[model samples]
Target: MSNRAKLFGALSLGACLLWFRAAAEVPPETVGQVAELPPMAGAHWLWVPDRLFRHSILFDGDSGRMLGAIDSGVQITPKPPLWSHARKEIYNVDTIYSRGHRGERKDFVVIYDSRTLNVKGEVEVPPRAADTGTGIALVGLLDGDRFLVVLNQSPGTSVSVIDLENRRHVGEAQTAGCAGVFPAGPTRFGMLCGDGTALTVHLTENGELDRLARSKPFFDVIDDPVTEKGVRDGSTWWFASFEGLLYEVDFSGNAPAPKEPWPLFTENEIESGWRIGGAQHLAYHRKTKRLYSIVHEGGPGSHKDPGTEIWVYDVPSRNKIDTFSAPNLIAPFLGPQAGFDATGMLGSFLSFVLPNMGVHSLTVTQDERPLLFVRHSDLGAVGVLDALSGEHLRDIDEAGLSGALLVVP
Candidate 1:
């Protein structure tokens, strides 16, 4: 063969190899598009993904079937989706950036119909800072779902109140050094400050900040800071500290009144290094009046570690009623070893190498047969457990569901 012909053949072979390598790197497409499932009866579970994708998924609480999803588009951070039973609507707050300018950004609250999942309306507000570190209640509905409150943090912290009925931005409230929005009353909400106090903001019927009040120091800000993710039981808000102390605050009145703090762990348990930890560590069941917490054994700085056991408590009696192991404890390290010694050894090694799985968020179904929804961040699995009997019902595998906020409606 000629020298030029030999060189041409070598180039063609090189090109083929490059094409094969590129094809191998490409991810396989999903089998089919996610079809919109009909909304089933009973409470629906909505979870917001922390990473990988910018969308919230709605699943049937009873059947563990995915009903639909609210896609937030690419590279956008969304607040926890809010569901209004009265109006049958889903509200999402997210930030949008300009095409040319990096600094040009706007925050928008988009409304969606619950049944069809169609875009109903959208209102633009000031841009908000994206803080994914702490689990904060950044969005809330107030005044019978007529007004929507959103927390904003461009460089400083504040809140924007939007009139949902009119689809307009009403006003903004300054909440410096404080974070998160916890609904206090029909026209009021509270924000946890860095000074160990909660600042309450009262809004008018038009969604303007009417007045503001700050509670006295309740927890130690320097020593053990309380998480912003508080579980609301009626007008009472229960906040958990890093060291496993439960602080109760009554927001039923004009101001947020702090109650006495209670030890979540016994003396022996404290000595055994039990502490409140995880992405979302506390859940409250109103009907049962029980507070469920994800706990783990850790040192002083391990308050953010994953949990291994769930401790149930009766808040009224201030008694520990029951304790159960998390489903992660019994989850198979490897599926179907089937007499394969290598597979069995690999499973054992994985069980030892991986951290103990724990509950990131917990929620109870609103219907009669209350099922506890537990999000295990380590395994990326959501387990449905019987709330009363502590039985593991089933597990739903979803990628990037870790550190997700679980909302039921």
Candidate 2:
């Protein structure tokens, strides 16, 4: 060999000798060891679905700490996780490809053990629920948590009912112009349509659709459209419109009963250009019978905009009782809630460069002492607030990207 080749060969041999020596010095680590999570409180756990990463992250609302997360599916569109306090389980409807991302697609429901957060079982369903966003109304539990109702919209619109006990798709209710799955009874659900009507579907005990009923159009579809993020109060469902109108529909009887619509904003508030927005996650406390919605100072056609404030209303009385400004969930490195603003390079970058997002989703616990959870979608942070007083309690950062919905158990 030449002189240059000999020099390189010696260097390579010396580097290999040093690597072997270092590897021999370090001990091997143990593997195949699994760990179980501790017991969690019923009302303290919050499920935040990260649509971008396609996973559902669990956080403790009391301490604002991330407990764990479960994968929703291999697909891009994510369905919000459903929690069953009765069965002590969590359910996620998903769609995955047979050969990674480009093969025969399989839509299914994944059951997870609430305590261990492990995969318990899975039920195969039709590929009907893969096109929906992470909306609270896209999925729900029926028949005492035995059946899972999934709203579908992929070129065609329908609701797929999955029998979790039998691990199969039970039935499909054709809701062509309708969207959302609001559980009205143990075996029935209501869906809001695009033509200003609602459909109530009653299912058999075997999880098959028995009959369907349609209610008269109560809200206008052309002028002011009611949002699909409707909240439930026993058998009554309250929906907010783009122009700050609350429409109530009762399903206590065999058919849906429509009640007169009420204005959520007063004369002065409407004049100042205030309307309801944030159609993904609206909070409703069962015990208090109050509905929480994100409100902002925007004119018409801005129903999907993010809101910097939250307004609470008494559903029974049809009156606005409380309104609170959304707190800054993201803490800047050197700005208003942290340091100076527009003073130096760091200050200017923190204040103007970075965007302080607003609340795009909301949820509240059902316990006696309730707490509200608000999500900043772009920031992937959550702000905890007192449900009764509307006071900012704490903020949780690094939650997850594209957290579209929040669920409390």
Task: Say which candidate scores most in lDDT.
Answer: 2
lDDT of 2 by residue, 47-94 (tens): 877878888788888886778888977655466777766667788888
Weakest 10 consecutive residues of candidate 2 by summed lDDT: 332-341
Candidate 1's displacement at residue 227, Å, is 0.9
Tens-digit lDDT track for model 1 on 1-409?
Answer: 3323533453353354445542224468788664543454345464645544667777766565667778763333446777776777888876666763365677788898877888988998877634464335878887488888887777898888888888999988988898888887778887789999988888877788788888899899989999887999666789999888899988776778999899999999999989888777788888888888888888897766667688999999999899866765212312221221212564345445544455666777655677887775434457778887889776654434334566676
- The alpha-carbon deviation from the true structure for residue 300 of candidate 2, after best TM-score superposition, in angstroms, is 1.8
Candidate lDDT (C-alpha), each: 0.71, 0.75
Runs of candidate 1 with Cα error greater than 4 angstroms are 1-41, 48-50, 73-77, 100-103, 329-356, 399-402
Candidate 1: worst-modelled 10 consecutive residues by lDDT: 333-342
Candidate 2's clash total is 1
Which residue pairs collide, candidate 1? none
